[model samples]
Target chain A: MQPTGSVRPGGRTARTKAAVTEALVAELLEVGYAGTTIERIAQRAGVAKTTVYRRWGSLAQLVVDAFADTAGAQVPLPDTGSLEGDLRELGRASIAMLRMPHLRAVFDVVVREAIHDPAARSALTEFFAARIANGAAIVERAVARGEAAEGTDPAEVIRMVGAPYYARAYITGEPLDPALADRTAAVIALAAREGLLLR
Target chain B: MQPTGSVRPGGRTARTKAAVTEALVAELLEVGYAGTTIERIAQRAGVAKTTVYRRWGSLAQLVVDAFADTAGAQVPLPDTGSLEGDLRELGRASIAMLRMPHLRAVFDVVVREAIHDPAARSALTEFFAARIANGAAIVERAVARGEAAEGTDPAEVIRMVGAPYYARAYITGEPLDPALADRTAAVIALAAREGLLLR
Candidate 1:
């Protein structure tokens, strides 16, 4: 997180976005998506309601921007010179991301919001498509390195890393400790190694 | 649905339970957990609210009963005489379960309700624990047949089968098409065969 004194090019605008994002984070952490609303965010952040609407426009946009701006947590893809290493590194990073109360709440809201909103549905779809494509690079690198099967479905391989953790955290109401990251990564690494994750 | 003519052991009591469970399913399908209430379910089912209260004390109880019903979906464990075959069969069954609109909604409500209610959380936990333990029988049989590794964690292997599908359906807001069952089952089967899913 850049210091408030730095101002960072966008100046007051960036600060406002950060402030609104923080408010969203707080609201979601306290009450979750069902209790959160545009009006509540405005009140919590002390920002004008019109300003929130003019800028973010909707819950999806607000959540996307907030997630993107959570202390500039755009983690770089790992290149640990091996598929297993990269996935384990990525798994650790994912666990760190999940450790953030606000980010996890944003994800929860997105899933819940998509249930009833078409825009959120599209957003959810595009978000995963883009991310899956981006993350597929690890498997692609592994294939080039002669580690994984040439025809392995890169997207499925990539998804396998996150499924166990997300299922426990979101669906099963289980505690998602860091150790589970190792377990999930081990399973995916083994599966991908065996060429069993082909599409 | 036992024909009204072939009354089961509980007779009128069983009828009442079935009717209440049906009401719950309808309520969840129509309005989700947040919108459903004892009042709505009683009104919809033509069963008295007091009856619902006296029989099932909480939303979690009603949901568990509903899920256990829905046409007596107590599927027998797959014993295809092999781990991969058993997993594939179980995967197909899971996909079929996911395809049920009312059952899916009941699961959705349980997840949502668990977030705000401790009783729902316990129900969710107990439901998974019982199901996972029961399903582990397949893996245990596989181990006995020397298909999977001896030390493979039966519960973890069982959890793997459901995690990928539930994550997509419940977390990523993705369409959990039937094809995914094969993909996930393949990964878990390979991992278990290779002893990677060992606790």
Candidate 2:
């Protein structure tokens, strides 16, 4: 699908946008965000620089859109009619996403830029929010199944279970580990079953 | 305190280390990490450059040491008899730490280096790991008091709760909000008690 902000008549159309985005992703993975430019993106995509600027406003926007496009496809949350099964599936998928080298490079650049660039930060947040929202929907389904408390907050749970993996990837500069994901899922599952502790 | 790998030499005790560390921190805050050199650190500390270099081999090492030194004397965790209270205490203290502009500038540089430089990434990891470990210890105490689950991974929980705040601050170049910290603490507490939903 075409990005919301990237259409101008007689400019790069939906098809060219897709091709340009793919080209951008390849260049980003090869040269990183600092080296990947509109010129490079156009040459790689076999499109003109005018076509690129006509579609996306800046290199940053193109990078954000390309990253999102790469991460757009969502894995279906497992439905074994059990919360444990659901968590395991969700956790595993998250781990896999963090392990994608191309996406990880994009994520690294986005996060670094996010610290200083408002537009980049907004794009990163938007990307994360959408993914987490999808995970939350799956969790809400579990809550409705009576596997979890009615008061369960899927978004918060996503933060609880998935945040650590992201932290490890960014903070520690490590690929995601399935074992860690499993452990995190278990801990979150336990918390859902038992209420918060009190001294 | 002197870094773990450094050797203890003639006449310099804990107090001297503290003084030197303080000097280094001041310089780090005043000048960004890249700008803070061994010569500057020695001059600021009223010690010889050889002394500073003898202890820490590089500026990255010195910066890491300075960070550890500055973050050493945190407000002690409060025994509020509730998970929420304990977490709030940690959150407040953390926000206070992140608010120091000089420190924030250093942090921005360090995080950037972490993304691009292997040695810098290692130093940053070590720096972050200690803080995460300290936070876990506080959580563990709460767990022992039955204020949190015994199985609660304090390190993971800290990462989960800490991620968004840092993400926002890192990406937006903004200060952590006290209210957001409260919300994070509340969500973490809830997740600890009710368990998060995962489908």
Candidate 3:
């Protein structure tokens, strides 16, 4: 009844959390957000229903936590010594991550859920805001190095680099080939050089 | 048991279809894709359940048809003699359309449905492809007017013009203002003028 020797300290708790998060993602992919259930996730995770219930409280919370666990991993900012090179690297990484089948499936569900669920929407907004802040550093470095305009909007530069690829991938459902990353980086770099991105 | 004077020819059939489509869209916006039911749609439309079933057969079909009906309206291609003017018009139109509450709700449902349903995905793909094709004429006319390079990819140019706005509107959940549309048009026109969009 007590989850059998689950009284172990931090190590076991971390392991249980990881297992539950993994199961939640797998269940989400298999059954979609509408069909995913806390009971099913508990069974799949090999954890007690009460444990899951006590920890997450609801399926929505579990999903947001799972998404944060997976997507919240630190993406190393490129320090390639040039604004163009750094943006190219960032764009490549962003597109490649979105292209992954598992990540794509997760994004589809999370974005749809965010449409109607305020909590999910807030979580997603926070996730993207964090990413944008992280990427803004690249533009800041460029400005310091005299590689970009002094007044360039760092967040706008970052958004420009990833915008085209995300549009193709999510909005229009177009094929996202490697060339798109290159083009996106090139266009943003061109715009920044022309002082178009300056605030 | 036949209904009195209910046998008008094509006019009645057209009216019935119009009513059913309206009901389907309203239901989708009200309860979302998973919750929308043919029975409810029929009830709201004042049509018999058998009529709904006989016409649409399934929710997926009904949704796709409804989407096509709504989005299939002609979006007149811009021909302002200059690529910049034309692209600006197109971009503004696209942003305005997406900002509409009704169309936004329909897009939210269709895009989410497309993720898990093959029928919905194909329908969306086809719809977008047609739109891209229609918008491509702007580039063609620009080329004829000597405003763009001969090798400019029409579809690519159109995509570029719309990509940033779509990205802001949907992916990053950023605010879509008129200024964003102007900037999108300017960037794409600049890139195309530089022959970067040439195949």
Per-candidate DockQ values are: 0.45, 0.22, 0.49
Of the candidates numbered 2 and 3, which has the greater lDDT value? 3
Q: In model 3 chain B, where is the ten-residue run with the lowest total lDDT?
A: B1-10
Which portions of model 1 show Cα errors greater than 4 Å? A1-16, A30-40, A48-73, B1-17, B27-40, B48-65, B68-74
What lDDT score is found at residue B166 in candidate 1? Answer: 79
lDDT of 2: 0.67
Using TM-score, rank the candidates from best to worst: 3, 1, 2
Clashing pairs in 1: none
Output the lDDT of residue B132, model 1.
Answer: 79
> Candidate 1: which docking quality band?
acceptable
Query: Which residue pairs in candidate 3 have backbone atoms (N, alpha carbon, C) closer than 3 angstroms, thus clashing?
Result: none
Model 2, residue A4: what's the lDDT?
55
Q: Which residue runs of candidate 2 sit more than 4 Å off their true CA positions?
A: A1-12, A53-58, A71-75, A195-199, B1-88, B99-102, B133-199
Q: In model 3, what lDDT does residue B150 have?
A: 85
Model 3, native contacts kept: 0.41
Candidate 2 at A108: error in angstroms?
1.8
- Top of the candidates by DockQ: 3
Candidate 2, chain B, TM-score (2 decimals): 0.71
> All candidates' TM-scores?
0.81, 0.66, 0.88
How far off is residue B68 in model 3, in Å?
1.4
**Tens-digit per-residue lDDT, A144-166, candidate 1:** 88788778899887777887777
